[model samples]
Target: MSPARVMVVDDHPVVRDGVALLLRNEPALVVVGSAESGRAALERAAALRPDLVLLDLRLPDMLAPEVVSGLRAAVPAARVVVFTAHGDHHGVQAALDAGAHGALLKDAAVTDLVAALRRVLRGERVCDPRMVRDEDASRSAVARSGLTRREYEVLRLAAQGRTNPEIAETTGLARNTVKTYLQSALHKLGARNRVEAIGKASEAGLL
Candidate 1:
């Protein structure tokens, strides 16, 4: 098989270059590109069409989930993996909900990063072990929120930065139907807007 084409995005030159260098030495991966900002990341990703993206949560211009959503919109087929120093479950959940394929802490061993890349490429939803422990909490919160599966589906699509129309197309539902579900989800989450709903859901582990 050909090596996986990868891109690195981080505002910090040190981290970005360090990660690029690490991936460059791997025979199974190729450093296809690198970007130091969110805008650049999106532009380069669209042009380079990488198979995977190693992204930082705190970019100079955007947060993790926003960057994840932007990357997803820029390259629908490319897998985004948040490679960050932050390990908070809320942030991790937000990234995953926003269409990230996986997340890894900066402290991860090179071997672990390689393993995660391989696993995610193979279609596994990879997460650092620390983030997995919060699943039960998120499940409980989701249960308590009382969102129906359909509503949850709409919410997840919204969390990924989809508009009502986009969510309608994705779920094969009408625009009104998507709006209704989103309204109900907002009510349940006590959120005023789509952004608030996504943030609340991520914090509650509902996403």
Candidate 2:
């Protein structure tokens, strides 16, 4: 059989290069194309029609979820696997909800990544087993702190190491508004800082 065609999308040059190098070494995997932005990935996907896409969550041009949706819309048969540094349940869930075929942390071992790619190509759902269980358990937990959608977005971005200014850029919210949402979310979650707020929100299933 021909090698499985794959495309990698990431803003960081090093990451894209490294993943390409790794995949090139795999006998059954082929690096058909690689892109530095979500928009570029979409355009390339249209031409290459790769079987799989390894997408990063942090892209300068578009949010990872948006990219996932666009890829799915453009290439219905291609499997998009999320490769992100944000291993939090919120990030993972967002990727899955956006129709990603698999979600893998950026820090995962190369061997694991190879395995995940193969599994996804075989039509298997790939995600952290523990995170899968956590999602189920979190559903049973009550969200005592009633935060609005914007507040949840702010909190989730904060957990991903984004500052107020960065969050504002990502969500198109004012910096002051992002700050206000963070403060309100932290208070409702009974958290002392962004980290604590993320922990609390994750526990409450608001994340």
Candidate 3:
């Protein structure tokens, strides 16, 4: 069988280099390329056509979930393994929702990382069971938020740093209505302000 082609993506040079080194030691794996940013990773992914991608959860240019979503669309055949230092429920859920084939913590042992890659190659899902429980709780939390679907869209745009006028323009809602929706969303999310609402919503996987 041909060796599995892999691309390593992380902002930290040391982390990226370490992962590349580990993968290179495996005879069944080939380190095709490494990238330090989401943009660069997307470019390299298109060029290299790697069979697997080791993606970080945080990049300077994009969120890990956003990057995973983009890469999956950009390269449909590549298996994405999310590797990140963020072990919180929100982080894991975001990675999975973004279409990661596997989710692994950065603190995982080299053996575990290798196994995750192999399992994903074999078409198995790889993530902690805790992630499942977290997702369930998050779903319940979002349900209780009681926002309409359009309100959810508004909240997401706001989280993306859009102003009220911008959200109104994008959502085609009046500025006052947009403000009202945001305020209502904030209350339902139990947030005191825009930043907190964004944080809560993202944690609940509403973004």
Q: Candidate 3 vs. truth: CA RMSD?
A: 5.6
Scored by Cα lDDT, where does model 3 land? 0.79
lDDT of 2 by residue, 80-145 (tens): 998888666455676676688888888888798899899999999898554553554444443446
* TM-score for each of the candidates: 0.69, 0.66, 0.70
Summarize candidate 3's per-residue lDDT along 97-149 as a digit string, tens digits.
Answer: 55789888888887888887899999998984434445566556667778877
List where candidate 2 sits over 4 angstroms from the true fold: 130-207
Clashes of each: 0, 0, 0
Output the worst ten-in-a-row residue range by lDDT, candidate 1. 130-139
Give residue 170's error in model 3 in angstroms: 18
lDDT of each: 0.83, 0.79, 0.79
RMSD of each: 3.8, 8.2, 5.6
Worst 10 residues of 2 by lDDT: 135-144
Q: Pick the candidate with the highest lDDT.
A: 1
lDDT tens per residue, model 1, 176-199:
999999999999999998888877
- Kindly indicate the candidate among 1 and 2 with the higher TM-score: 1
